[model samples]
Target: MTKVIAIVNQKGGVAKTTTAINVGAGLAKHNKRVLLIDLDGQGNLSRGLGCKTKARNQFTIRDALLNIQKGILTNPTKGILTARYEKISVMPANKQLDAFEHSLKGDLDAPFYLRRYVNTLRQYFDVILIDCSPSLGLMTLNALVAADSVMIPVDPEFFGVEGVEQIVAAMTDVQRKMNPSLSLEGIVIVRRNDISIAKRTNAKNLRLRYGSKVFQTELPTSVKASEASARGMSLLEYMSWNHLARAYASLVEEVLANGRN
Candidate 1:
């Protein structure tokens, strides 16, 4: 069965996309067929996976949503970009998603559209990870509704804890009203060198707050992550020996251990 995991955080720079990219890569490295869906209008996830998406790129989540709106399931694989030697495929996004959301204003089923779209994709891949835009909007709602679980990437900073609270509340609301199946899988601390008392305190607070729901794996601040993004590649592909790769690989194991729980 296919499992959908949405990596989300309303705050930007929290490594939501970074977690999505590397975790997908990590899963693919283990020979899992993965499909990454970029729901962010910035298309950073798409680009980070090596897609050179342009302004006029119409082949995106927009078209897929439109198809769902038309009461049909779209064959989105036609536009999915292959990466990491075909172990991973991505449905790229563009600025068009901004307009797509605008067009969804007042649509009662805006959040359900992505669920409907993803329902058609479960058979093709072992995993489908949605890289949500840094907000709890219709897109993220849709992601939550479609996903089996959510993974939040919290930066080792003050606001990171606050943002996790916001997202957790939002997910609870979504579970109550939209997707009762949506459970928060775990929270991963990112950019965490833990070199300072403050960072260590923040980590402790998060684990205390979320308990075992917080993932044991934490990614330290690494320049190699930035370099990998600059090269439009996953850290594992860019430098397999990098500690970041090892961290993400461990994260993948934790995720699989969770195993639809």
Candidate 2:
């Protein structure tokens, strides 16, 4: 049984896509067959994994959803395209995904669309990581409905804290009305500079409020992360010796441990 995890944050620039790309890579590095689903319309995860949107066929998640709605029993794994990385497959998203909001309108089961799609691929991979957009809209709701657990990446800033609150509230709603099995896998504090007293204090408060849900590993903001994405690589592939890569590696272990139980 594959664990479906959504890497989400209502706030952008919090390393959400960065975490999804590298963490999925890290899991694959550990021999776990991972499928990365780029649910964000920006297609950042698709590009980060070296997949070009222009080269994709009409068989995207959009088409998969339409087929499923027509009772076609479309297999989710069929929509996945291989990435440059070994053991990692991707369901690449295109900018047209933004139209999903309009496409799903007047459909009562809209929230469960992704859940039904992922159910078809549950046995094909060890994990399915959803790279969600930074908003609590239709797309995010679909990802939440599909996810067994969620990982939120937060920057060490005041607005990040507020974003955490909004995410928690949304999770609560999902648990109550949509996905009763939904759990918050962890809260990752990214781009932390321990030398800054304010950052350290903010991290401390975050831990105090969230308790063990806070991840033990903190990912520092590194130029290597951006450079790796620009070069169509993960941090582990771009700067294999960097501390950030090592941190993500450790984070994957923690995620797997939590997920297995």
Candidate 3:
């Protein structure tokens, strides 16, 4: 069974897309067939994988939603694009996704549109990673509905923790009403600065509060991540031996191991 994981944070700049790209790439490096679904209107995941939207008429998740709205189970195989790495594919997003909320407004089955679409492709990949927009709106709700687990990236700052809390509350509501199987896979601490005493203390306090739900791997603040994104490559490809790359590799291992049980 494919494990659908959403890399979500309602607050932007928390390394959400960075984690999705690298983690999906890391899993692919480990021979896991991974599909990265870009649900965010920003299209960062698609661009990070070296794809330019203007080059072609790429079928996106928006098309899938439209198909579902019409009660047609479209096999979104055309939407799946090959990534720069082996065993990794991507479902790119476009600016038109921003109009999805208004388009599906008042539709009773709106929340499950993504869930139904993802189900059609579940057998084709070992894992599906959703890069969601930074909001608790319709798009985020669809991602949540489609996912079995969620991995939240926190920036090792005060507001990041608050964002995690908000997402947790939203997840609780989602579980109660929409997808009961949805579970928080773990909290990933992104852009941590151990040299800063305040940041270190906050990271510790978060781990203490969240306990086992917090992932052991912490992504340090590194120029490598940004450089990788700018170069349209994963950190593993850009800086193979970097600490952040290794941390994401470890995260993939942890995710795979947890999914087995």
Q: How many backbone clashes does candidate 1 have?
A: 0
Query: What Cα-based lDDT does every candidate model obtain?
Result: 0.85, 0.85, 0.84
Q: Model 3, residue 194: displacement in angstroms?
A: 5.5
Per-residue error for 201 in candidate 2, Å, reads 3.0
The residue ranges of model 1 lying beyond 4 angstroms of the native Cα positions read 55-57, 84-86
- Off-target runs (Cα >4 Å) in candidate 2 are 158-160, 194-198
How well is each residue in 1-261 modelled by candidate 1, as lDDT tens digits?
A: 889999888888888888899999988877889999999999998888778678465578778888789877446566777863436799989988899998999998788998988888888899999999988888988899999999998876655477688899999998999888898889998867757777788888899889999999998777898799878888878887888888888999999899845
Q: What's the TM for model 1?
A: 0.94
> On a 0 to 1 TM-score scale, where does candidate 2 land against the true structure?
0.94
TM agreement with the true structure for every prediction: 0.94, 0.94, 0.94
- Per-residue lDDT of 111-226 in model 2, one digit per residue for the tens? 88889998888888888999999898888999999999999988876444566888999999999998999999999998876567777777888899999999999997678998
**lDDT at 200 for candidate 1?**
82
The candidate, 2 or 3, that scores higher on lDDT is 2
Evaluate residue 233 in candidate 1 and report its C-alpha lDDT on the 0 to 100 scale.
Answer: 88
RMSD (CA, Å), each prediction: 1.7, 1.7, 1.6
